[model samples]
Target: MAEATEKKAKTKKKSANQTLVIVESPAKAKTIEKYLGPGYTVKASMGHLIDLPKSRIAINVEDNFQPEYITVRGKAKLLKELQKDAKKSDTVLLASDNDREGEAIAWHLKNAIQDKTEAKIGRIVFNEITPVAIKEAVKNPGEIIEAKVNAQKARRVLDRLVGYNLSPLLWSKVKNGLSAGRVQSVALRLICEREEEVENFLPEEYWTLDADFVKGKSSFTAQLVTYKGEKPVLKSESDVNNIIEEIKNAECKVVGIKHTDKVVRPKAPFTTSKLQQSAANKLGFTSRKTMQIAQQLYEGVNIGTSRVGLITYMRTDSVRISQTALDEVRDWISKNHPEDLPAEQIQYAVGKGAQDAHEGIRPTYVTYTPDSVKEYLTRDQLRLYTIIWERFVSSQMNNAKTRTTSAEIQAGDAVFRVSASKIVDKGFYRVIHLLSSKEDSTGSLPALKEGEALSATKFYPEQHFTQGPARFTDASIVKTLEEKGIGRPSTYAPIISVLLDRYYVTRVNKQLVPTQLGRMICKILVESFPDVINETFTAEVENDLDSVEQDKLVWNNMIGDFYTPFKNRVDEVMEKQESVKGFLDETTDKICEKCGKPMVKKLGRFGFFLACSGFPECHNTRSIPLAKCPMPECNGEIVARKTKGRGKEFYGCTNYPTCNFISHFKPVDQYCPKCGWFMVEKYDKKNGSYKSCINPDCDYLHSVTEAVEEAQKEALAKENQALKLAEEASKENQD
Candidate 1:
């Protein structure tokens, strides 16, 4: 007991003169503590101890738009503990992230605990969490930038004003619980408009003619590009037939050949937008998931003897790299891949409106390659880290070299062309090739002079339809948002998340499609608040926010300029806009079991369902049936349902507590020819809509077009028979 008490006293004495470093996350705190070693005590703030409460707007619109911030609920006790630590330490250093949000956090921390301590309070920041970086930051602490804090405050106050005012109008005019956001509404509009384009698209037919030619031992296919010195525009089967008949037996000869060398440069390192886009495209990760995983990597990961951050700050828009990082990466390449190293350092051009806050996302230390740290990381962590490392190293490497050969063949008046490319040098690709496809496009052909004779083995004409603009996937949407400057680095994932959480958009095979409710809400917001909820105005607002960060504009003045006009628009729309509450409901033939009143299909938080028309008097609701159950003698119907937690859509039997038939895919009213089991509708961007068997052992599949036609005919026949039965039943009731 004496020894234990003495040891505790010694520990207290040891920390009595220590400097305290506060960070946003526990993982980051742990990593920094290891680097700071003995004279410092580290603690995690857990991100934003104080912020505007969620229950109210918390903005004093009348008093120069002052924000009313309170200690975040459930964090009061944590704040008290931090204050106690601050009072004990000799100095407090706020070490959060390296962005506007982080600057706000550091400023908030100084205010929250300054009264409790006589210690010097200052801010310290680094792009990556390493021993050298952390120690160097502690050696030179500076005051928080007031400009960054004001910029964050400006964004917060503006969003609250928009959401708090516009949401009420949405609730009254559209439906209760409906909400609007300054940025998310714009994203919803983009998706809804794209859906409209798709629905209105009319595909037109086109044809391409190709010939398989044999040159000695080499065989290659070439597409006909021109006919009689004009571009071929084959619109129908007759046009293709006419062209084929005119050139079927003409002697084919090579008329011209050209060769050229091409140089392909490496892409810049990952910015927040580029990381999200690349992860979505190559790794099939959503923007939210990509950011989540990236956060984990940036905070820290456990290695052999300590915790270290694997990547630089993840929420940056800059492609800038520090000289230290550049030197280390260049040295690594010189030792490992000497041939790929460039003579001079490479620098990427920053985009027109990038924040340029921190270095682009990259590995903190080049020595910790992906393969070396594979055992310490999760599968996803490794995957994300690998891409970051590759992109950074490749950005500074030499350009790739390739050679291409183009050959033209003439058959009567028709001219066919083919091109082949071969990689002569793999420079940056030495690292980035893992993420890229490795297929060689070169088809070996015999070297021949101009006017050489070639024999045609077969001629084929293929029919195709011009496809409409594709709907936005996670990757494409992020790219579009970045290009249009709709939101900043921190808001991209949250924008998608907010829309999805509110059910404004749903992922249909990884493609974002607005729901009926989503489309209606978008229409209401756009038609009512065009000036505010538009892409151009929103982008301009973003630029103004950036100006505030640069200390060129006052945050309060920016808010003042936007609020009065926006508030007036909201008031105008509320008083004038018509209610669309029951506008989307469809009256159905289903009669409520509780009351004799007919049932109507209404959209809800989950999805569509049948509700009693006599609502307030007799309240009842049931799922709408999509197809009859395929089980023998089951006599049940399949209906759409959502999983409880995730809200993922699935189909199951309406007789759920009784007959348990469920499928992840929606069941169509068609059965497989090979196996007598029912087929379900499935969709993907590559294949469009198709049908697949639900049975695990069966492999039955077919296109949805023919299946839908047959199902519709069957449905019409069933409707007629049901009508005849209903007439007889009515006559009997009258009797």
Candidate 2:
């Protein structure tokens, strides 16, 4: 520890002419340093330089959420490096992301940097890393926001309490290596619960009629909503047919005409959630992809002579606009879109329970649009910046006005309504009206009072089935988890990634489906530890953590309130020792070589593997191979195995030295129908996507992996989901 301190001291002795800014990422560092000019040097913390040691639950439950954080495993060296940098600079500025976690990182960096040098440490936050924002932020360096730091600490402590206390229960009830979290566990429960609901739902078949109507030259179609204002009182196609028969016999006439002109204002500027949702919808980019791209945009883009942050902070829940940016936007609207400007400045109202302290995400300058940087940015950079720019500008514009006309047709006992809305003025839509598939277009209609006759061409009837709840999309799941207060924004992706990484969940057509292992884990948590997944209990814990952040409560006390009862529950389970077992054991469709029956899964020191249920009789056990290796030389299959030494695992050729091939990679889990060797991915490090074979003995190889591209997207999407879950979990716990 003394040696570590010495390194930090040396780092603090840098000259005043040299200003070093430490951020959470190298990408951000590059962007900021470029904008700040020659006197400034930037470095990355590579994400939290200090964290609670992974080896233990470091919380003082009795001391009002007193946290005992340690330099996290594998981070000591990195922290030492930061300390050295700190000592070498006149002023050390912590420029991590602007969020609770980022604040904690900034605090940790202060300690890490100070341990090396006597140089002053300052906290600086730039909503955007552009030259103007960066300079302004540096000029007005604010003290570290303690509320954010406390919030982060509270969350960490709470997570440790939940994870450390509950994980042991999972080990006993579920399989080893399996664990649960305050956010992750709740998310799992939600998915599992939704899956159950879907399974239980009996789809009801109903019919709907669409009437194609013509008014002179224009033709429009409207779907049947209800019969006599009572929607779907009918259950079957026969009932729908009966309604249609009545409509056919009666003359179609307009009973009531309702027309109203309303302004459809633009949505608030991009909160992390809104940006992610829009990207998901518009670009088919996952939430993770959106953030990764946004991060690049926020950190900085190379613009001719200098690199700059393109957009404001990417992780925020607030819709509050920065006054300067708002002013620029207002000016742009007045000059370029006079008609779209509101009569007065439109102040967007933020939702209740939103974090409004942070500024809404927007481009650094309204004029320095994405197009201006097109030549310098990568493909993703352009797309994301465009989104940010459009969204910000739209947020300040006037509402779109529409002359809406609704016609209620009364056909004897059955009444049907069709509505049309015409854009009176483009308003905000002129700049950034997010076009959705269901958008309806309207125009001036002839003056028609109630009791007017209308002509219709063809009436068509269609059958429909009620859908069960939607499966969690990367976006929907994140939103749902957030609404329920399950987790922080940063955690959403990690939880999802962990589930998939651990083989607990699989994405089938972008939908999360619990694998057998995932299902088993859920069942165990539910049966053995019901409290872990309790909605109110989970939500309360999250709220409690938030309370700690707001300084309304102490972290240690929060942990104590939770850990005391939780520890008791865990201990009780251990002492009582319910020899609870799986009802339907793991089974594989793989044909058993000896026995005719399919192989049944057997529990072992490693994990669930295929073994003859007639163990004593057959005595055959084999690793559940991902795919059979087809390499003629190795003739080995890819099996999930832990690596020795460094614990870094990879697929090895069963043929050993004769076929010396190994892969540290995720398997496609597909077998070569002809060769039988599992195809592995590789990269030249220069080009991109490189798919190869796990068996070293095999000569097969393929590339074009686009590893960074795939990873960036997945990472961002995971981050988004994790963040939502974490935020929700925090709220739930805190409440």
Candidate 3:
């Protein structure tokens, strides 16, 4: 009997030693399992196995605004698998990302599985997925932080309150399918206001004069800066012409020469916002694309025989780097190029309101260079990893040095100045120069004395129009949002994406352009809910969320303060606001085919469409015609159509059954100059709008405005030359 009891105890002990690990993604699980070998079973939750229902507002307003949690739809099978694994294991470790969302995910998984198993549960976090880091995290695990979970919950509830309560009001007042968000509405307002400014802007004419001078064999050009000991303001072409006449025969002499040494320090490593901005400007990537690639690098990639995370946490705002990482990078710099190493290790300052929970984005291992692991990563993954490696490596290097020379030349009453810079030392720039968009070299300048004489070779005057405020691009918008504290690192990409998905903004020439529907929705929201969409108010709410994360403020109280007044305002707007259908719709001349009633142009979620005036009696709708059909031997007109699933716009013949002609480009009335084929307006993010011939055989394309302006200029020049010749002939006759 004693021997039987000993055998049973031994079996129980062997079963109790097995452990199960859960993470947010399969890739992350795979990499972590590689570090922690056998006796551990790893599984992925695939992000948020539970959340609030979408059918209704799940918050109990009377009960401290407690959210009603439920197993998320379509996650029952995944939960069953996790529960089965948890029941058999003695311990469970929740290894999610180190952020508010990740914290909430870990908390949810714990609540779901703890009831079914006697396993001890804990949370483990690591900034990077290196083998050493993973093992260290597993050895020292901590419980889930309630403060971080509460912060994430508070944000989700606030957004749900605004979106659920206000979206219905919009549907009744404006149109159906139009939704509003706390942060996206503010972004939409910005785009609409910028569009208004662009429309109302009036260009003013301006001019500048430049002179070319030669001291010996070298030639240099300088702009006119001062005239008659005062700064000249060339407001018109006449002013430029007068300056040109004065400098045409005047002798040029170098009056002032100055030299200065400038140091260009290396920028800090990649914070989430800075990384998105740099990727947008340098790689022409949208914020969404940048974040997507960054996630893949952070999760893990298969490099050779081992799986490894290429970068640290990418969703961080802090510029802090670990001391060990700094030491390792410094040693690398000293070994590879001793001249580029700084005297001491450099430390970067953390920005205002930073959470500082994780290190800045950097390569997990300095030894795994981008080139060494290029074969394992995709093109985008490799490009992003290269930038992360270069940025972090360069951040610890020495500053670059440059020598700048400014030469001021006097030509009669006008003063022309020119400045040039040459690189003296390529320290950090040696790595950054490969990723920079613009060239840094200014070329070498010839030596000149202050009193040296120079002969004026030619004078040129150019006319220019003053430009208005530039439209916001993806990079500029992210920068603006960061500066204003409107959103955090995780929210930037989603905010911009929501605007685009809802048709509130369109990318044209890499600039955000508000559509007509976007303008209408923004006007309605701005006028009715001024406090909700105000930038200052929104930023304060973001701060409140941060306070919740820091345990300074209770999540329920903050939501109450915002919801009480916000709900009242929403009620007032719903009662007082008038329907915009009457103002937005216009009567059309075409009659409906169903009931022979005149059609009216009405705005829908997609765009403008023609609907019957007698809607109840004759329910008919059709797409509005954009232009005449470009196809030969077809009398049908071209109407706007959308792709089946993606809803992308295209133009097609109205008589599609008989004459099947379609064009992705928007059709215009004008014909092409080269082939006499109908022209279409094609748009791209790089180029705003251009006209192209419909005939693919003819390669004719030009900008819409540039072609017209060139023709006008040529006609005006001919008229001016004819008048000059007539005056010369008359002078000859008189002589």
Candidate 4:
């Protein structure tokens, strides 16, 4: 029996000698495990095992804003498994993401599992999950950086203090279930201020005169640039008619011609913001969707025999590329497209505010082209990877050469100018032009000499209006946020998402429009917390957070500086601010059957609903009617409703069990002229706003330009009323 026990002890000792590696996700772990084959066990932590609780504000304001970190609920079993594995192994390496949040996660993991085992706990980081990167990280394990962890803690504490304190005040003052954030509030203000601008803007009428000219079997159209030897600003159709009448009988000729050669260089590799904007414009993807797809690409994706990370870290501001990647790409370009290769390698400039923690987003392997791995990826994955590959390869290529020719045509007292460009050398355009909006083909222009006669085919006059500033879309908002330094790479997508999820903003016609409740909330927040909710102050806080990450500033001091004044302001607002809860409620003609009280349209978490005016005495609510159902003699009403889990808005019939009618787009009150089907409002970045028939068989479409004109008129009247109110309020303050 003693001999048997000795053998079992020897077997246990051998088994306990293996090293355990912990990662943030199972996908990453599986890739690393395949790379590091024997004697190394890889397990996933599934993100942070211990984090601040979400139910309440878990910060100690008296203790220099210390956070009360706890094991995230539902993660206790996972933590135990990690501890058990650590107890059996002699070494444990925390291989989470390579960022400040990842560093904090690693630090928390070490502290939690360190006491449970005698194993050596360390940290390993790699931007890309490939065999080379993983092996190198394992060969040189390091400790978690304290400064990064502190920076993450400072941001979390600061956000908690601001959000937790201000949200309740907003609930009391504005409406229940409303929320506010340090960065998100600033974004809200931007949107609301823009909406005010749009409301107050008065569009001026404008006109332009154009004529089609034919010369040598080629036709071209050119705008009249100068009239009567001066630049024209035709503000009215009368002005356009006067010019057209003057130049109608004049002989047109190309009096002068000029040619110039130009060179166009490639753009830098993908930064987080640039990638989001490009995807939004080119692929019609929201920032949130782009990041989600990017995350999957960064994590390991199966390429045939094994899984490998297709791209480097996606959430980076730096445009810097690794030397190893640069060399490989340069070599690949030289062999694949030798003429496009530049004499020297190109390196992009890093931004002023970039921490330069990771290289810019690029493919991990140059040879694994998009076409080679097309079978393994989804359609979106293939498209995104193709662009990344094309961009990286073309960024290091030679400049594209083009020749532009400008012609000035003289007609009576007006000068019409036209220009055309022809590509001299494809260069980088050989690879990148496929993805760019601009093509490499030579422009269409007829060859003409100086003093050549041209025949006018037709005269055209176009009416136009000076458009107001456009509303923010997913692309423009992300670009604006990045330009103003309001948020970081990881926070950009989530900020927009939170606003939409909370009903603070609604996407109308693919443009973010402030709802009635949203505008009211912004008005209150701007008035109550002007100092903390502005862009400059919020940007300063972001800079200070970055400073803490670099160890130049302490985290506790940063939180103290923001929390003191901010808390005082919150207290003052809570005490002094008047409630505007019922101000936005619109009294409707419908009566509540349950309480015999008038029903009013009130804003709820999901959307507008009909609530009884007598709230305490009689509680009754139902979906507000939007339009009549278009089914054949169904006798049902369409109402706005939301989905179960995500609360996404949809319009459906009130008689759901009996009559099944639903649509993602809001139903319009009008019917299609041809098929008699109901119409729905739709918006796209390319097509602007319009109404379309809901029937699959009917293709009736109509532009909403007339509706927009009516809205503008209404907005002008409302603007005058708002100005009068402001003046009265000012007078009251003065008295």
Candidate 5:
């Protein structure tokens, strides 16, 4: 068979009249719609309309390269719509993002489009949303890059294998309601390990001494540096006190002064980490929350008057600004602050590990100010957009200037250093206020210079102890995850969500603290499955998956290496570990009521309970029942009740649902350890059949609330109100 004959018989060429353009998300539909005209049909895949199946573990582990593919359950309708559109169009244009994931999405779209038409399926990589970029992408339609596609497929299969194989094992061994994930488990392990470190840390006593001095019209503060003309490093309270006594009686005077010219540069536009931290500090948002809002802004937002993208791409970690965006920003700066704009553009070197030429974070459209979009956006959307816009704008401005003055005082051979900064110019700081913050309020040295003398106002001793490392929060975790390359932008939210749902970590006062369950899970992962929880292991797995996208390694080969050890471990645990119970987790605490013997507490299929120390011998076991109402003010005990036929037992309010107190597990008869409020049952219809007392009034609800967007909880309240109104209307009609 000749090659020409085979090509002719395999597929028909596309007609010149029809053109199909496929984008990644529905939210982007309108944004791209405006750019495209009538001859083209534009549709969104709603962000990867196809994905691996959830029900079973699908992997070809024997082969070095195995790729598992599945039709995501709900995307069928979306696929049908896309397929319909693709068939009608002569040419299919894959207009997804330029990243590896976007490339993978385009390939998947092609696989599912099912068009054998002569019009060839093509790929377009648009780095940005401007009209020129779009036009250039259309002109340079490329074939589906197979390496990126394989990388995505590799990641999908790897995650599926870990989840599918590990989740069931968790169900069997741990609490039935619990689940484990790949990236999520790693994140959980990290948080749990951090909590342990914080717990085990020992604080040491230490003290620092400072002195206040006055010269002419200027007052300055300095800290005690050393003793006998040498810096004395004191570690204990007694040592610091001894030094303080020597200095307390001695006369203090400024013996020397030093000055230096300084410039403070504005921070470059936000990378993913900086943006998350800023969002958290300024808006009291979680990293996930920031990302969600940024995604919506990136996709497109209806700013009432006009739909616009408030921010540039949010997934990037690079800090290289494009010359075009820089030029436009410089123009804005010159128009607003002629003094702030540098004589020429200040070109910053690309950050280490940053890719070439991809601009630093900036607003996609700089002209759209947050104030103008306030009425149209929610509080959160506006807050994030404002920060992004301001930061990007400031990045283009000139460096801020500061005048610095330093004075070293001598008090009987013990020296104290004082320093203060005065703003010479607001510079770029006027645009980026967060970067402009300065603590010193006093004016700089008037006529004072080096070798000048001044009188001492007062001296004071301050006592302090070294503090432990702070616990991980969502923002911190996101930073860690990105830095480690353990997960991607999309996985952060789902990872945090899963960790919380599994009770692997809990939030208290906005701090992420590992729960007992979370710690236990971490212990299990660390001790038994060290490879799975290891940061290096996770990053290596991710890298290999990235390689799959590059087509450098076969997906099946990755799974093969993973399965041998995994299966061996599973079998080993299945045989010897008859009960998915660990000695530490399943404790011998519960004293048997029948024999007064210590009974061990182990989690069974239904729930947690204490069985006789000698289970078969004593045969004395009973269900640990729910306790009294957790409400501190209420004086009622709870009883177990199943919803009519749903054999799932739940601890209900003794007040018969009147108090609305319920939980799948027995609520500890105490006030919420946090919030100081009543600990009530939390009933989640999807994924979670258990209950927790994560205080409804707490802000932690913000993170989890996003998880239940597909479910409606307050509907019953509205429904009941509507029902009551209808009943009253019937009475009014009769009257």
Candidate 6:
């Protein structure tokens, strides 16, 4: 007993001088450990150590909706390790993220570890992972915010109530494996509604008339704008032809000329929603992919001699940049881009209800340019970081100056107008112009006076049809959700991922298209549980959560008020609706080999599959074939398969164990004429759709390249034709 007491005393003395820090990720721990140096042990919690159980609701609804949190599955060992480390340290710092989720994680860690150790517990948060930032955070630590924890708890309980209470109702009323969410269902409703709008749209044909005219030595094209002193709407070819006939013979003269100088301001630095949208449009990245890459950049990237976080916290909705960051970036501009620097620092407004806990997404260090660290980053990381750097730099630069000219030419009773713009100063555009697709056109109408005679060169009329409402892309959906206040910066990506995983929506040509099952489920939820899947209600609930975070509302009270009506509706639907589990099953033409019974098409968790009608007697199921295998000497048929987690569809051979042929693109029946390889459908948002050879080494792929070139040529031809007409007119005037 005397020896044991001495050892315990020695251990306690050693631990009194030690400190431990816990973070959410190992990458963060490694970077922070380096910054903290010796005498401190840094560890990663790998996210939450405790969460509500997945097997049940785990909420005591009758007892003020108190949550029952247990050690998360597979995290017991991690929790033990964290406690052991805490026991050997005098102080424990919980350094998670800087948001509500992070606050909840820190609170949970403190509660779990405090009982096992005598260490004093505190919380520290830093938007960026850098030596300076870490040292500052360690020097000044704070307690976990109880309000933020309650807000996160409120969101969790609300989601659990909606998901757990409503999912079983869907399984009974619609189909098995069907689920609903507080935010995801509203997103599904948006997509399904858009699909309906598209299906029900009727096309209306219209015509546009353009006239080529010569002014002095310059030629330019103008669109017919006004007829008989009023703006004209040409609805038919006859209307267009009549105007063309009248204008083709009439002597035209310049009637009016106007010039205006305008200044174009730079966009605010990236918020989470804006970053997701920009990455989708510029880099062809999905929202989930964007968030994943941003997380990596926020955690830390290994540079030459040290590890450093490339950007600030990415999951921020505020566009407000810190005064220090603004001053530093302006200094960089004054030194590197002297001509582009503004006289004063640029400030952006914070959006309504923004947390404003962190600054907008920007590079941590201005000197770590994308090129300087390109070798340390993957291709995706480089692209993302480049945009962040450019956006932040440009946000502090002067506005772009442009001069626009508008000319009106009168031909009989028709008025044709041409407008052109020239950049007077590049300013911030000097940096962003490299990323833009728009070309600056200097081809303006030559100096013209009122009543100057102009000769018509050519008349072109084109037919057009009104387009239907566009389907949601990852970018557009995130923008809409943010605008509607349906989800926050962190929830947008996960909401999209959940919808995709549930097979409620599929991406075609990068557009979200609701499946038949998705539409059906949407109809049921919209009709039965209008409050839950409603956009306004969802937005209100988000506001309520924010109120909880601000201490303006009680979390339990909000959940109780919401659950009363929600639970009543669930019970009503459960008692009223008929079972739709087998409603989707349809008899197929193929017969089972063993029982001779006909097969039935049924929806599974992944998608539709062919199953024997006599289930127990002849239990057989097979994937539906899409096309024949494209590989040479392969007799296997290609079948539609889904990815394991996200459920993204791809084509693979039925004999996968042997043939092992797979294609990300859907296979077509036609073979390439040049290479004899099978063709697959390829999609582009602008180019619509086309087919390409599946073989990477096939010459047919070159044909696609040629097609793209031809499209580019066509676009360029339009621009060149306008310039050529101006040149011809200039030459005519000179003669």
| TM-score of candidate 2 on Cα atoms, chains taken together | 0.74
What is the alpha-carbon lDDT of model 2 when measured against the actual structure?
Answer: 0.72
TM-scores for all candidates?
0.90, 0.74, 0.88, 0.89, 0.74, 0.85
For residues 1-735, write the lDDT of model 2, one tens digit per residue: 999998888776532367788888888877777667777888888887778877777777656657777777787887777777777777877888777888999988776667688667889886777777778888877789787787787777777887887777767765566667777766777778777875555445556777865656766666666676677566667887887777775776777889889878788887777777777767777767787788778777678987777787777777888778878889988998987777777677876566565788888878886667889998877877888888889888877788889877766676777777777677777765345434647533455568766666778877555555766767777777667766655666676776767666666546776776667667766765787676677778767766776778876666666677777877887777564457436777777878876788765543467888776878887777766555555557667666778665566655566766556675785543335556654534243234665555566655222333445677789999999999999999999
Rank all candidate structures by their lDDT, best first, as comma-separated numbers.
1, 6, 3, 4, 2, 5
lDDT (0-100) at residue 102 of candidate 1? 89
Clashes of 6: 6
lDDT of 4: 0.87
* lDDT per residue (tens digit) for residues 1-735 in model 1: 999999999998866676999999988888888888887899999999999999999899889999999999999999999999998889999998878888988888899999999888989999888888888999999989999999999999999999999889988977788889999999999999999998665556678999988899888999999999999999878998898898889999999999989899999989999999999988899999999999998888899988989899899889999999999999999999999999999999988899898889999998999999999999998988999999998999999988888899999999998888877788888887463444434665568669899988898888776677889988899999999999988999999999888988998888998987898889988988888878999899899999999999999999999999888888888888889876858899989989999999998875678999999998899998878777778888888888999977889887777888889997777777887778887887665767898887887778444544556677789999999999999999999
Report model 5's TM-score to 2 decimal places.
Answer: 0.74
Candidate 6 lDDT over residue span 659-705, tens digit each:
99989998777777887767888877543446888888875752333
Model 5 lDDT, residue 176, Cα: 60
Give per-model CA RMSD. Answer: 6.8, 13.6, 8.5, 4.4, 16.3, 11.7
* lDDT winner, 4 or 6: 6
Candidate 1 TM-score, true structure as reference: 0.90
Over the stretch 1-735, how does candidate 4's per-residue lDDT look in tens digits? 999999999997787567899999888888889999988999999998888898899999888889999999999999999999999888999999989889998999999999999999989999898899999999899999999999999998888888899889988887777788889889989999998997776666678888999997789998899988899999878999998888888899998899999999988989998898888888788889999889889888888788989999999999999889989999999898998888889978998888788888899999998878999999998878888878877899999898989888999999998888878888888786343445554456788899989987787998776677888988999889988989999899999998888878988766888877777888888988889889899889889988988899999998887777888888988998888776769999989989888999888876678999999788889998877787787888889888999977888998887889898988777878888777888877554556898887777776544455766878889999999999999999999
In the predicted model 4, the residue pairs found to clash are: none
The models' CA-based lDDT, in order, is 0.88, 0.72, 0.87, 0.87, 0.70, 0.88
Residue 354 displacement in candidate 5 (angstroms) = 4.9
What lDDT does candidate 6 reach at residue 690? 62
lDDT of 5 by residue, 133-178 (tens): 6677877899887776766777777677777666666666665656
Q: Write the per-residue lDDT of candidate 3 for residues 1-735, one digit (tens) a residue.
A: 999999999997776677899998898888888888988899999999999998899999989889998999999999999999999998899998899999999999999999999999999999998888988988899999999999999999999999998899888988888899989999889888888897655555668888888978998888889999998889878998888886788877889989899998998999999999989987889999999999899888887887888899899999999998999999888987689999999989999988899999999888888778999999888888888899999999999998889999998888999998877788887776463434565745678898889988887887665566778888999999889888899899999999988878888768999888889889989998898887898899889989999999999999998888888899989999999867779998989988999999998766788999999877899998877776778888889888899977778899898988898887777887887767887766454456888888899887534544665677789999999999999999999
